[model samples]
Target: MHFTRPRDLVVAGLVALAFVYVAFKFAYGSMPRLPTLAGATLIVLAVIEALLAFSIRARIRQRRVTSALAVVRAVALAKASSMLGALMLGAWLGVLAALLPRVGDLAAATGDVRSALVGTPSAIVLIAAGLWLEYCCRTPEGGDRKHDDHPTG
Candidate 1:
């Protein structure tokens, strides 16, 4: 499978943002506040993944421990999670954009916008962590001759 691209994730997020914003603009429905607890949970997940990435990389390089299958699985999971985070961030940004203008006019819009602001950064942190994980999963130099050790940006 191809590696995850930053452009792809940005496009996905932009699309979601537009779709969500349009829906909110038309007042078809409103999204609930993003939970602070969910943000905390995501932060924890990012920390764990970041630590795992470093640990796995060290193990594979030192030859003290190695598991190609495990690394592959981790890479897959990282890609998926990063993409998901990007998608959610775009949606949250869109929601905030849509709500900011209406916050003063509408009583509840303020709270919704506030939550979106909070959640957007949290999602960004998750994306960064996932990308780091993907980077760590790359094979060390000499492991792959067809391509260098550097990962696809």
Candidate 2:
């Protein structure tokens, strides 16, 4: 199913807004041991990517050029966004991985294996969510490939 430009824009806007809100909350809220700095950085990057994706989608809808320029641009933006998302996910996972060992140590000290395992899902979920978002942003519309194959008259 094809999504309209307005719908894409709305979705991107909402995503960006949500990220901005989360970043703000992370930066200002009082949460002990929270990955506030990393969260804020990831949110900011996501906001930029969502906006770029929205812009590329808008340009593609215009159909002003039939030389596959729009497709190329969209693909480039999507790749960039995907890379950033991956980087953010990796950084988040790294933080969690680092903390996990410490938590494991604490857990061992207290004989609490469950507590150590509890945070494992946090990393897993973060990676999964990042992959989902990357997939969503990277999946180009069907027409994009057709445009790439067609010669510009």
Candidate 3:
């Protein structure tokens, strides 16, 4: 789960590459509306995912939490991030499904479906990378804890 790990870095790199590729494809109209929508949703999700990953990294670097309360705060933040991610993903897919068929051009429709299928794996990769980053940030090391000291005392 460590962000510094080679596997994690590879995954992150792959996800980033896929994001760029999909973005470019969508922009040039190589991707249809449905896939484009999915890609767009994935892009947004990726951003959130990256932020969560960064937060995890920060938490780990800060290592300022040994108590149950700190654990609770971390868990709560992780849960909220997860919930938001899941909801957004669901909504994105739902919206895409609802709108895709209504648009004309069967070929374009098929293209969108294909893009979604291809892009989904990449999206999953991105999510996993983000989660991994979060895991990395939650360290057991006590050295990083500084906020535990009350400044006013």
Model 3: which residue pairs collide? 63-144, 63-145, 64-145
RMSD of 3: 12.2
By summed lDDT, the worst window of 10 consecutive residues in model 2 runs over 107-116
TM-score of each: 0.84, 0.39, 0.39
Number of backbone-clashing residue pairs for each candidate, in the order shown: 0, 0, 3
**Candidate 2 per-residue C-alpha lDDT over 1-153 given as tens digits, one digit per residue, 9 for 90 to 100:** 121233443344345445544543344223234432334444554555556556545554564445555545545555444444444444344434334445544433222223224333433343333333333433345533433534345
Identify the candidate with maximal TM-score.
1
lDDT of each: 0.79, 0.42, 0.49
lDDT ranking, high to low:
1, 3, 2
> Which tens-of-lDDT digit does each residue in 27-143 have in candidate 1?
724455545445546677788889988998788778755567898999998998799888888888888888899888987787677777777888898899899898777667744
TM-score winner between candidates 1 and 3? 1
Tell me the deviation in Å of residue 37 in model 2. Answer: 1.5
| CA shift of 56, model 2, Å | 2.8
TM-score of 3: 0.39
